[model samples]
Target: MEQLFSHGISDSISDSIPQQLYRPEQVRHMEAEAAARAGVDMWTLMQRAGAAGWTCLEQHASAEDQIAVLCGPGNNGGDGYIVAALAKEAGWQVRLFASAEPKTTDAQRALQQWLDADGEVEPLLDWPESEPDWIVDALLGTGIDSDLRGDIRECVEGVNEAKLSVLALDIPTGLHGDTGCALGDAIIADHTVTFVAVKRGLCTGAATAYRGKLWFADLGIQREFRLLTEPAAWHLQQDQLGQWLSPRPAHSHKGQHGHVLIVGGSQGMAGAVRLAGTAALRAGAGKVTVICEPGQEFLVGQQAELMVLGLEPEDPRVAELIEQATVFAMGPGLGRQDWGQRWWNWYLQGLERSDPQLELPTVLDADALNWLAESALELSSRNHWVLTPHPGEASRLLDCDGSDIEANRWLAAQTLQEQFGGVVVLKGAGSLICGSEGTAVSPFGCAAMASAGMGDVLTGMISALMGQAGALNITTEDSVRAAVMAHGLAGEAAAQALRPGTSRGLLASDLFPWIVHWINPNDS
Candidate 1:
């Protein structure tokens, strides 16, 4: 935490968000208690919040800029009242729109302060006569659990229609603070400056699209609050991942690092496994081997650096492969055909030696997920596996529709873990890694991953990280989270590099160089 009173805050507010994510309910439960403990009154806290928001706006707009301030009935509205007063005092052309009278004492006090300052409040019917340069959405805070109402919905629509640069306070109206799902119409702000704590919804689902650029202002009460509950998830950033990254020693050899075997590429669909193999190698796997179906060896082994072999029951090397590799990535081009199924069963059986506990780092993705669903293989406990599923594949695994998996991605990831007994990565806008460490979400998503082979690349990255985690001196949980951040960062990089003019269109292979670059940025 840095000093909130100094210009150091300017950089902090514009450039970064807090590391912890809190649910709205959680913040509500703690705010008053936290404020009281800090000897700060509700009015004082509201003043700080209002000041923080106003400071953010002032950076983008000057006294000459025309601005509109929207206020509701709650404390959020109080913040708006203060902002209006501040703007009015600063000689900016400002308009205040009130949906309802101040309902709380703090809000009433702030409204009276604005009135004393000779700030005029207008009805929330339409925009001001002069087109405002910006709009501040302080209408609804984080507590909204359901859909917007008649007047609120209309006001939200008006704000959206205004289309001017808008700064949303706390959260945008109509966006559920916990789930990030827009109940009806949500405010599409040009910037959102969240206060105190970040809500889980802002980092996941549909919320990511409307959230624009996010900034955080903690309101200078860092030590006053302690987390009473665990966060819904942790958000990982690209640059922060470097702390977990260490360069390979010059004396290090292939034997010291980990060997990763990619099992898949059944029959005609060899591209997927090939991508996964190359990704594993790029991601720092000491040695990568592709176990493809018969006659597909050459296709999967396109790179001389990777060893490719077809699975043969008669081949001794084929039987020993599962036991020999440090980690297994089972999926990608794997079909639900007999050949794929046989290999899946063979690997599972091969790993169950003297130890009763099923402990092997494996990532199940693509067609491997389909086979798991088809067979309905029930495991008694966790087998040290990671299941990477996009919404469609998640539905198949959960025996539900794609909509159900997406409806609540967090719940879906949790339910999958309970059923399948492993870490579950629900791949989407906010890719989640659910394990014993709880769920960590990477809210940063790249449009490039929308392409076909993106999942394959992710699978390879996760598997390779898991394979080499020992040499890296990182935990599986940390490795998984780091891999996710790296993958998304790579995708975002590829998207930017491939389409600097406009962001669209990407192949799976586009991320290969990025994977290598992120793992070893010194080379780049």
Candidate 2:
């Protein structure tokens, strides 16, 4: 029987996971040369990739289990054929389906090898009539940039419709290796075994769902390939916490940890500001001040530690708080009403008038972002700020549709960072952070984070982290990436605590305790 649980890439392979990600074209251009330099031929590399994929399959399948391999016309198909030949030798029932005869010499040789192994091939006009334990997707490789068409599209659809466990070779068929977008449709694999370096496209965007439980095999070419190429982005991992955050000094006082000012919380939406303020405190900000709309002081300050000042947009106290704040996190519960607008203008004007050298780090989110999208005010690159925008808010900031942002999250993130300066945290599943240091992708976060006010908590976490960036002896980019990973991990932890192994009905505030736990990386 097939394994019921996901045993993600084994520990031995886990250590080999590549942090540096390359674009698909870069991987393609360098792989052949790298393989040759590593004293391996293309066929030899193909055999290594097939062997790694078979190992993953072995983890899922028992002896004599049925397996179906869908081979394409290219080298990706060659990988599928090699896996089929191995399964056949291992005493498994193998049914290989080909969309067309192998197109490349390497693939053709692989097809002949499968034939030599006594493996029969069938046309992939439809999914195999006999339901198999697993489907191997090798229909398309990383070169795909447009929508899938004709028989291949049908084949991809059939694989998805069949709803069998799928082990995708390289990338799930129909996913654009550079953009992570589905070409018309893509195979939704339960496990994806990718070769060489992890592709940048597989790290973000719509590819998140299609590429499940990603496993990588360097195929003995990573060192050579890495030497010849520059990473498109670095993958963010939980282990980065220790590298980015240090334990507070034992003699630390509230004044030393930095103050985080949360400027928002208009009217009935005090919960948003409250969440942000509380999260800031929980994340180890020494002091948290909320300059909320007048009459919201009680609601925003319900958390006793928060210094809540209900001040009008024009209040002098607001300026005082701004001057004292180590970092400003704007936008939570900042509605688009006149009150919100006044506060937005007030904050920007204060920044404009302040000495450029003393520019406070700011994080803009929610309605604050919406206001920025609508504003004609020019923001120079010198402004030290981080913009945290969900896809919808990002669409506004970029003047594109949300679908467009989701279609290419990496592009959207880079564009935002280039335009906005400081850093850009494009929040969502597999959030992308583009900062002055470069781009990074956070693989944390789960479905439970889809609820409301989640972004608010993230805003506070980012702000709190930024406040301590100096003491942590890290850059603003480092703080932002760490906060993103922590936020996602906290969300996952909260969901698990609510109901182990499930992600549902998790409130944003539920992340508070987990936030405390993750923020203190040295504690664990």
lDDT of each: 0.80, 0.85
In lDDT terms, which candidate is top? 2
Cα lDDT tens digits for candidate 2, 258-377: 899888899989999999999889988999988888888888877999999887877766666777888888899999888899988876676667654247788899999898887734
lDDT of 1 by residue, 4-100 (tens): 2223332235447656787888888888877787777778778777777888788877888889898999999998888787777767788898999
TM-score of 1: 0.92
Model 1 stretches astray by more than 4 angstroms: 1-14, 128-130, 227-230, 312-316, 345-358, 521-524
Separate clash counts for every candidate: 0, 0
466: Cα error in model 2, Å: 0.8
lDDT of 1 at 116: 84
